[model samples]
Target: MTAAIWTDGVPVQGLGLMRLTDDGWGDSDRDPATLVQVALDEGVTLLDTAEMYGNEDIVGRALGSHRDQITLCSKFGVYRGDSGRHDDWYVRADPATVRTAVDGSLGRLGVDHLDLYYLHHRSEETPIEETVEAMAELKQAGKIRALGLSNVTLEDIRRAHAVHPIAAVQEQWSLTQRGVEDYLPTLAELGIALVAHSPMGHGVLNQNADGELAHELSRIASELGVGAGQVALAWVHQCARQTQGTVIPLPGTSSVSHLRANVAASRIELGDVDIRRLTAAV
Candidate 1:
């Protein structure tokens, strides 16, 4: 639907898109367009899409008139076929690949310049240094505004940041997944923002990590006066209050109402007890 999460570090806000694995929109009652509009009206400024999602067309269609008002992040690395082999993922980012990926993303997104581009690289085949250098050059050349990385280690981040100024780092950081915590302090020291994908724990955390985003929403519908996604988003906000608020959680849905509820979570304030329960439950 949209990533209503924003990092206080940069002025740009965010809207993280899902690969949309299924056909039905959330709640089985909404279409893509209505949900996109609601997010735009509510101050979500960054739209995240990936080459793997096969939803660039849908994302492009939903962007409509608000394209200029948002910051868009599209990722590329592992090349996929229609058959969905989806493997042999590139652990390294190459200049040629990054260039070609940006060109393709620009074509699919129908835009000239990308707001932020990440090296969807995730392996050891190619030297990450070579790839990050290319990313730096791309930013200097006006192909992208900012450079980011995903699924990387602390050492990888250190090496990459030494070569270029990274605007953000996208990772799987949620109440259930605290691995990033071990390294997030280093990121904070480096001034890099955390784009927490699956911040709702893929619909598991708010649903108590039950593996269904919809069911999770139902479980927390009454307590916080919002959906489960809202509760989870609120938890992230609290997590960052003690940190840098650099924790930008991405909770997406095809439902307009749920998307709004997700945004409303930005204003939610979970009590210290609730925060303790949510944090430890993970």
Candidate 2:
């Protein structure tokens, strides 16, 4: 039962809800309730979502009964009403807008308070201090348990944390995409956890099971009697351990089987030699 350390001292580790609903990327035939239930039963307690993903309502419906069992996390800042394209959403992190967004998210999710709320992206128009002050107000009012930032740089994190203590930061991190590694020292210094989205390399590592990096992962997985994806996730866990920061990889999947596999990856341990081989392969 390896766990990602949160600032609040609660255990959190598991899948994200990015693909739980149909968002024009692909059709999802999976029932939201079933998906959420299966994830919980498998010990994947951290469920991350965003208003921009167009699946907050579905997530709300699914977690209505099981809300107490999950560490629910959702993001604001992206205006989803203007266009259907995911990238077309506009940034709105002003104090007024942040208030409106959190209220809307609360209504959609049927939750009075969010376990963690995030500013989906940095808005150049709005200063981070103002936005975070507003978020700190929410915490004081008991609307959110913790503050989080997504798609933010180290500098942005410092600015925001100066206003309020940031509990977590979400970034796209994977074996092939290690840019987020640069911010680990800063994150550790601030005592903020790293929530890694796309921890599977966007399925590239799984797709290239016989390729170079994947080949090494497969070899290691075979020796450990685990799947290659599990090995990759273990590498991330190892990175977090080495950096003295918590790293929780949110690998989203609509399939129940895949969800179980991803959750089980949390328990895989990569030895020193396995880590060196995997690191060199990348």
Candidate 3:
């Protein structure tokens, strides 16, 4: 079994979550509450969601009576309105909005305190310091255990960390999308963990995958008797290990089989040769 690391005292390794209710991508017929329980039974303790996902209520219902067994993480600073345009939904992360957002998230998730709360994105209108200070106030008030930032640059991270210690940063990362790698060293220096979302390349690496990188991953998976998605996740995990920083990949799945396969990837230890192959493939 892969060893679990402590993120603000919460034990977690490979993270998992059900798709947001409004995303129109998840299985609408399958119950998310049951899926969350299945994940808990399989040892995937870090559950990630967002207010923008518009499924916090469903997550709350699913988390009922089992909140203590997992680390609940959700993001703020984004929402969807009637307009449907992306620009109309990016809310400013000012102090007042931060307070109101946390309250709404808590109410929706049916929890008194969140294991980790993230500022969904950097707001152009509000200073990062002010937003972080508001988060620190929430931490002081016992409303949140730790703070995180998502989809941010190194400068945003530096500014937020200066105001308050950031426990983790969530970003899109996978074998095909390695844009976040530039900030790994900075995250390591700051002693903050990296929560990687879309570890499977939005299912592109698993479907009609024919490029050199995909071919290499498939060969490795065949050799290991595992799915290609598992190999891709293992690559991300191995990169984090080599960099001396904690990386928890939140692979969202509605299928039980897929969830189990993802959890199993944690035990897939990539050797130096395998790492070299993946590095070259990327």
Candidate 4:
């Protein structure tokens, strides 16, 4: 899938709804319903959610009359483990589970189909090809428009892509976190887009925190006459441009002001020297 094919007119910045349901991140005063509308109004058409987020119903109600106006995305397979810790989540992508999960997601989201449906995590007990084959069946059944993979290895991508064309890969990538950079060449070669989740270091890069990258972002942001968060987004965009792949920074925010600011950040451009400086600082 080429950048144009995967993006398909979706903006370079998207809205992540994980934070909407997480009390640790979102504002207690902000309503998730209104945040969805604000995202559409800002042209952030890529609205991402997940079964794990536990807010599909809220997102569904919020989308309301404008569901057709955005590329609605969701994920499956990830389930709570015994410990129930964030890092202890488990995955199950058997053919039976895949069918049951999609139906449940559709019911919760109040939609007949999903624009993009991702296998949230690789299953240790199941083969990637089998999981993707099940997803392809869903696409054939008109349940999902495109297939995506998240938090998957490069080998997983190759094996899954062989079964079905992968439209995108969702992972964490930002100025402060660049592990996903290693996958850029392969993703570009495959023509699969990279949907960068937590592209702002999960809000650390935006705060006035004390750190080398923070200071550097502030310095470059001051020179560019924009906020540091915008600089971070610009770097992600420039990095994607260099790789010749579609990399949409999916940042989440319950605050309307923060959402608007992030949308505005999508347009900030950075020079080569500043890009290098920010790249090196990280």
Over 4 Å off in model 4, which ranges? 1-8, 22-29, 208-210
lDDT of 4 by residue, 178-234 (tens): 888899889888978899998788887887545777888999889878888878877
2 or 4, greater by TM-score: 4
- For this target, which candidate reaches the highest lDDT against the unseen true structure? 4
Residue 259, model 2: lDDT of 76
- Error in Å for residue 69 of model 3: 1.2
lDDT of 1 by residue, 1-282 (tens): 012223322432256776443354453346666566777788776678887666876777667777777677888786655565656333436788887878888887777778778877555876778888888788788878888888888888998889887777888767677898877788888878888777777776555545443444454557656777677777776786678536677776666666777778878887787777666554
**TM-scores for the candidates:** 0.84, 0.88, 0.89, 0.91
Off by over 4 Å in 2: 1-9, 22-29, 80-83, 209-211
Q: Which stretches of candidate 1 lie over 4 Å from their true place?
A: 1-13, 20-29, 81-92, 206-221
Error of 3 at 266 (Å): 1.2
Where's the lowest-lDDT run of ten residues in candidate 1? Answer: 1-10
User: Please, what are the lDDT tens digits per residue for candidate 2 over residues 85-172?
Assistant: 6566678999998888889999988899898899999998999999999998998988888899998878999999998889899998
Alpha carbon lDDT at 202, candidate 2: 76
Judged by lDDT against the true structure, how good is candidate 4?
A: 0.84
| Candidate achieving the largest TM-score | 4
